[model samples]
Each structure stands twice: as C-alpha cells, then as structure tokens.
Target: MSLVAEHVSVSIDRADLLADVSFTAAPGRVHSLIGPNGAGKSTLLGVLAGDRAPDAGRVLLRGRRLDEWPLRELARERAVLTQEHGVTFAFRSREIVEMGRHPWARTPAEDDDEREIARAMAVTDVAHLADRPVAHLSGGEKARVALARVLAQRAPVLLLDEPTAALDLRHQEDVLRLARAQAADGDAVVVVLHDLNLAAAYSDEITLLQRGRVAAHGSPAEVLTAERIEDVYGQAVEVIEHPRSGVPLVLPVR
Candidate 1:
C-alpha cells in the first residue's frame, strides 16, 4: 500500500505551506520525514493521510486518487498519529484505544479487537495504565496511549508526526522499533523525526524536506551526508557510521 503525492501543494489564506511536494513511500518500508520546525512536515503528513485536501496536484494511493476512496475505506488503509491532544472526557485507557476500531466497526467491541488493543498497549508499554483515566496520565504516558490507539487501527499506512518527542531515550527506541516492525509487516510507515540518528537507524528510506519542499530523498547513506545535513538543516552535522550497527549516525557540531 504505497502512497504517492504528485506535485501536491497546500495553500491556506494565500500562503503556500507546502509547494510542489512529491514522494512515494514504498510498501513495507519505514520512510523518515525529517525537517526543521515549520518546514511543513505535519502538513504534508496530513495531506498524505487525506485529512487535508491539497490546493493543487493530487495524492494517490496505489494508483487511485485519494478522493475516489471513501473516508471510512481510507481510514482502514492508513492511520495518523499527530501530537497528543487533550482528552476532554474522562475515558479509561482501554476506552480511548477502542476508538481506533470505530472505522470498521458498528459494535462497541470484539474478542480479536480486545486482543489487538492489549497487544498494542503492551508494545507501547502502556498496559499498566489500561484501567487508569486518560486525563490523569503524564505527557509521555499519554503519548504511548495515543500511539496504541493508532496501532489498534491496524492500517497498512502509518503516519507518525514527531512520535518520540515526548518520550525518554529507552521509550524512544521502543517506539521506533515498533514502527520498524510495522513496516516489516508490510505497511508503509512515514515518521516525522527530529532526531536524525534515530531516523537513520530505523528507516529504510529518508525524505529530507526544507522550506516546504524535498531537499533530498533516498537511503540514509545516500541522503544523510554532512554537507546535505548542513544544506537542509542550516547547521554543521557529522554523519558517521555507528560502530555497533553500521548505520549512519548524525552528530550535530555545536
């Protein structure tokens, strides 16, 4: 289930936030979307997930236009995990997760659905908070729960916007590992990451965006050069091979 955005541009109030953006996220691969703040990373993800309509060009899912697919059908195909939001209701953690199943479901719950929810919570390390009120959880705990909701959605395409921003180093690795597993299981996973090294470690492909357009797109080895990092991020960064895993390691020179 690959997603292709062909010359897509998003404009609001006569301001072009994203211009002529185009890229293909190959199926069963983790494609990292890396850019500085206000570079339109989240806007692009919203367009890719069909949450926002592009002012120009098109978004295609497997050769079909996004508008051609029913909203519910599209929901079944892809899921988006944005920055965590406030939960006005005093819902239990399990109840919050179960909302992800609403797109394909008519009933409140199912046997398989519960198991999937539990699995997602366990993977996010939020199972301990299952019975807790969502409103009472800490920021990081809530983030994990929100991710669990997306996992319960079980879509083939997963779009994560700064997923590890609120997590500790250990949970950051945990979340990225889970995302890699989802990609390995034949899903197209696009993650917006501020940490370039983590992106390099987990992604099969990297799409670097700068000033609302693609600056580079390729494997981490191909796109994450020191020169390229400086060009896109406006900072000197050292790209070296990780001694342990052999992946590209990005070290910012302060």
Candidate 2:
C-alpha cells in the first residue's frame, strides 16, 4: 500500500512546524525525508504516521483517510519507530520486542509470534541482549532493541524517524540495510534521515525540506545537487557521485 500526504500543515502555539508538505511513499520502495536542523522533517514524519494531525490537509494510507483506519487494523498495517526510546522499565530485550505482538495477541498468528520475535531480534543483532534489562543497556543497544520491536511487528508500511541515530557505523549501515530489505519485500518505507549521504545511497527517492516546506523532491541525483544543498542547508557543500554506487555524497566544503 502507498502512503500519501497532501498539502499537510502543522502549527503549535502560533509556530508553524510544517507547511503544505506533500509526498508519496510507494510500496516496494524507500522514500527518505532529509533536511537541516529545524526544517520540520520530524514534524512532517509525525503527521505521516498519524501521530499528529495536519491542521490544513490530510494523510492517506492505501487511498483511505489515515484517521479512518481502525487503530488495531492500522497497527497491523503500518509500524512506526520514533526517535525517542526512553523506557525506564526493567523489561528484558526480547520482552520489549514481544510488545509488538500486542496487536496480534490471541489471534491465529499467535503461535508463530515466538519465531517471529526471535527472527526480528537476530536480524537487529539484539538477540544476544535478549536477557538484558532495557534500562541497563547502552544507548545504542537500546536503539537496536527498539528496532527489533518494530521489525517484529512485520507491518507493510514503516515510518522510521532517525532509526540509526544512536548506532555505530556498522550498526548504522545494518539498520539502513534492514530498511532496504523491508522495502524490497514490497513494503513502503518512509524514513527521516539526517545523513544526506545515507539518504542518497539508500533511498529510491528523497524529499528535501527547507524551513517548513519541501525544497526539492526527486531522484537523489536530481534533488541533492550542490546548489540545492548549499541553499537549503545555509552552508557550502560539495555533492559528488559515489565511486561504487554512483549516488550523491554530500560533503561540507570548508
């Protein structure tokens, strides 16, 4: 299913967060949102995930209004990984992952839930931490465990807000790889990324936001030009093609 947002706008306490943002995240592809600080990428993500309502426009999932979907049905269709992971509970890592199954509890698929949880943990590399209390783990460890929980949900549409924010280099790449794998399996993946290079390399399409609106949206080669990056980011940057992948690599020019 596709996720589409049109003319979306958000405002809080007279502050405009997102203005007329529009984009489509199609199934079987990865769509990334990227921008400089305070560009409203996170705010826009919240709207897309139905966590926040747009003051002006609407978000649609598979052609239906987002608010129209039943909460339980929506939970089974789209999974979200937000930026914050501040649980202070003493739950084991796998136990936290099992929470994703709440939507499926006592359902017919309940029997396969254990295997799914195990697979999700192994893939996110949190299987070894299965016995560890979530509060006792490091920030990166907690991030990985949070990711495993989202994966265990096995939703067709994923909205991830900085899913790699706390990871090391290897784990960062692993997270993006997992996003790509999910998209390749015909899921719609919408991610908010701070790393322009990672966004260019992994996304089938990128939406660049400036202030509260989209600055550019298209293929990485088209949208991530040096000129656009400099204008939107307020800094001189060099956009070069990657040697192995031919994707745009954003580098600041000092």
Worst 10-residue lDDT window for candidate 2 reads 101-110
Roughly what TM-score does model 1 have, to 2 decimal places?
0.95
Global lDDT scores for all candidate models:
0.90, 0.91
lDDT for model 1, please: 0.90
Clashes of each: 0, 0
Residue 140, candidate 1: how far off, in angstroms? 0.5
| Model 1 misplacement above 4 A | 106-111
Task: Please give, for residues 123-217, the per-residue lDDT of candidate 1 as tens digits.
Answer: 99999999999999988899999999999998899999899999999999999999999988999999999999999999999988887888899
- Per-residue error at 133 for model 2, in Å? 0.2
Lowest lDDT 10-mer window, candidate 1?
103-112
Give residue 5's error in model 1 in angstroms: 0.7
Report the C-alpha displacement of residue 115, candidate 2, in angstroms. Answer: 1.4
- What residue pairs clash in candidate 2, if any at all? none
